[model samples]
Target: MTTNQPGHTFQVDLRGLVDLLSHHLYSSPRVYLRELMQNAVDAITARRALDPEAPARITIRTGVGGGITVQDSGVGLTEADVHTFLATIGRSSKRTADGDLDLAEARADFIGQFGIGLLACFVVADEILVVSRSAKTPGAPAVEWRGRSDGTYAIRTLPAGTVTEPGTTVTLTPRADGSQWLEPGTVLQLARHFGSLLRYEVAVVDRHGEATRVNDTPPVWERAYRSPLARREALAAYGKATFDFTPLDTIDLDIPLVGLKGVAFVLPTPAHPTKRSGHRVHLKGMLLSDQATELLPDWAFFAACVVDTTGLRPTASREALYADETLAAVRDAIGERIRQWLTGLAASDLALLRRFLDVHHLAVKALARYDDELLALLLPWLPFETTDGTVSLDEFCRSHPVVLVTQTVEEFRQVSSIAAAAGLGVINGGYVYDRELVHRLPQVRPGTTVTDLDPETVTAHLDSVDPGTELAAAPFLARARAVADRLGADVALRSFQPVGVPAMLVDNREARHDRRRAELSAGADDLWAGILNSLSSSAPRAQLILNHLNPLIRRLAELAGTADPQLTETAVEALYGQALLLSRRPLRPSDHALLNRSFLGLLDFATQAAGAPAADNGTKDPR
Candidate 1:
């Protein structure tokens, strides 16, 4: 069919695109040179693959008035290729859009999949002139395409005198405002940051006709695959280089074919290790993200790793790593890695592992509560009480005569009973409610079962009972009940038989000590306020259980019976204050006030008793 009139093609405003390229695409203008160098590297990599034996060289020449010119002896682009690359938006020559490309399959071969590197030129250059002769055809005519930021472009054959053989030379007339691109220092800086990992040699020609290759292309990624290196060696080298190691405890969680790599030891802790790091993440062998925060769980923020997965889309500038299913797999892999690392450490070295537990106890605890699967794996690393001081779960199970494993509180009570029947101490170190659930041990196991007890409660329970009299603690119990009711606390009186301590303030849950410490260190008032509100409300209520048999309580009781109110009140106030301190709770305002007044009275009494003037000891009137 013949068309009567030609349809108008959609045209982009290159000026606006240039503005976006310079101001929006790059946060720092210094990266303009980096983007150009990366493009040059891509061209070199493609060319070398075609002619492996050929010597590949790139020449960059610049002067104050001449602007910048880059010439590359690579597989030069044809007019058709130029139209497809520059004129088309989505037709990237680097990446394949196949629906099913296995990451494992592709990682062995091709890289640089997304093609948008050329647009970076618009950032600094106001005008671009491309002179290219195709390598595929002999005696092919050299063509030149010129374009400006205004979107106007023209194509014509280059003059015979300046034509080059089988290569491409791009001349960039940079905007006066973009003189930084021509500076040797600026070019070197760009190469160091972005092109340091480039396999090809990148050089710049200074005003004196001298060429300087300013990149270390043989990065660690290119090291011998079979090189034997120790962990400390790698860490030391990374430290000396003044770059972050950001160690990753890498564990491949493939069923049937599992791989575990412990790389966590490589990460260097920053002088001020915040939640951020400068580590780049790679998927498989391809660079996915330089800032891969989501690759790890929040708990693993302390860890820094370059997670290279072969399952992401790298944009043209080789900057953005597009998110996809590969990211999910990465998350799973890292979580499993951390889980296995802790588990293996726990099972192997008990003493060495305890140090890790001590340092990261809060992180461990958080993982235990939220990640039960990981918790089960990490439990072996956790310290537990044993017959011979502190032991790990593995140690406890291995040494104990009767070992019990259960998830619920009732199951814990049953375990306690079994231990008691055999005259052994039951350890309830399982889940969050494991400690609180210990109270049911007596009921489940009857009088024979000695349940696990907190150290504080043990002291109070042991001291509360009198050895001689079984039923003479009535007066003490009555006063404790009155105190509990006044404080609106949960009150209970049970035999401290399981624990050895005389009495303890029991009922408070564990504090978010790590989170609080972090908040305090950060000086985040809003975060602190939120944490304080939650802690005060959710913290377990404490009951003051009096040790009726203890001489201190008995003496106080006898003194209370006396007609002297001042001494009795002072003793009561002191005991209450001691209890509050032990329980880690704030004392009631009236009680605090009473203690203050009684303290003043005691000072006066002591002064009078010592024969000092009583007037000097009296409270000073607020004048």
Candidate 2:
């Protein structure tokens, strides 16, 4: 049989709750100081609502025995008020009994939303004592409420004149493990970190009875934007103080619709694209977090930003801002501000633009991928390596309307000298984003055609041999081709400028890979050799171009008719090896063996011409 059970309320394990708050809810035990200061600020704000002339001051004192006292001259609590607000967890007294006050409006004036601000102190302390006399309850005796972390609490009426003025004083007797936080220096540091920009004055009292104001009245960012000159100077000073480096430029950001105002500082040093930019963020004039990365777009890594917003809400721990639609809008607004600053610099200040490009061109290039306007302005200023030297894109285009680009630095290096000698300008597209940018140039700027110049295409622009020269070198070319066939290359006689070069090695991507794979499989066993041979069967063959204008090549062409076959073959191998070395291609074991044999044959020929005795067993004779 089923019976209906009576409904019952769940009782909270107070110790367990305190442990959770201490270990998990709050980010750190040091945040207890921030929680206390927030409560004090909220109390002061409430007091101002009642009497605008009330002193808005918070004082923190570190006691010698083992406790800390935070006193605020704000709206305090009466005996009944303490029982209702302090005794009950999560019950905030920032509202009235009528429940007419809206939570959002209260958030505008008050910092403490959850009444658990006091319970946050339980992370470091075991007992909390509060003595307060409300400003509304004038002439009423002060009340004292004491509470322990173990779910026990008491309240009683204090003697009259206990508090000469309306205010609240909270004293925390720390647990044995948390005694380090009771030091005056630690207390002062924590107070300044969270309350440095608070509107009200905050003071830390040392044991000598001297109080030092720990916060500035108005933050530097808030005061600096009054004038352009002042903003520049203030940003310079702030950048040095915060990042320990001078900023390149300052970008002023103001999105009143989102209640955001701050400056984005352009970093002087180059920032890697993958690095996370740490931005200091504040909520309602109080420091929230120093590492708020999500507040800016990912591409804005080149800037370090500091912002204060009344529009964005912090998570429960207050260590980071909530990621929501409002935050997304704010992030875009901040990014747009930075984008405007960059484009403005590009339009008006060429000298400054050059300086920025010198240090941060990579960052600008990253942005230019998506921003056409920026790309348009930055294109002429960006530099690229050309056959002549490093020159701006505008200069390169002025000389050669049809741009020819090599895809890598090595490829450019291999042909740059020869191309320059031939009066052709080839751009080095090896740097970051250069190749992609070159490819996009046609779409961005009309009437511009960018051609990728590989080894094969480059040869077409070289000088070609006349019919007479080709007929004279035909026999030599046939012999050279027969020798090069063993190396998987074809040989041709071509006349080119820079007649001192004997030969040039030209190959397309497929040909280069084929040659490399053929070299790798030369000594492999049957299985591996067959696999590589199959893969390389479709590889394009390389061309070995002989410079017919060079005297050595012309002599070799004549020697092909009467010289010994071994001597002519050695000369051909030597030319091929020299060309390979000039192209910077790695040599295989077979190529090295051929090179050794050719060198030894040439040495023996020289020895015979000198009328010296032949070395025995191919060893050099000691004369």
Best by lDDT: 2
Residues 1-623, candidate 2: write the lDDT tens digits.
Answer: 99999999767677788788878887778888988888888888887876889999999988746788999998888777887899877788875654323334555766666677788888788899999988877798899999997889989898877679999999999988888877788999988888877889999998788998988867676774667887788888888887788898888889998678888888888888888688988777678888998988888888898887788878878778888999999989888888888889877988877877777777778778888887887877777789879877777777777888988776776677678777777888878788888777777667878998887777877778889878877777887888889777888777787888998887677877776777679878889989999997576678888888899999988877787765677788788888877877567676787777767877887787799976654522121
Write down the TM-score for model 1. 0.66
Candidate 2: residue 60 Cα off by (Å): 1.7
Cα lDDT over the full model 2: 0.81
Best candidate according to TM-score: 2
Per-residue alpha-carbon lDDT of model 1 for 525-606, expressed as tens digits? 7767666555543444445554444466656555454424454444444555554444444454555765576577667666
Candidate 2 Cα misplacement greater than 4 A, ranges: 1-7, 11-27, 92-104, 224-227, 407-414, 430-432, 442-446, 465-507, 511-537, 542-623
Clash counts per candidate, in order, are 24, 0
Q: How accurate is candidate 1 locally (lDDT)?
A: 0.52
RMSD of every prediction: 9.3, 5.2
Error of 1 at 331 (Å): 4.2
TM per candidate? 0.66, 0.81
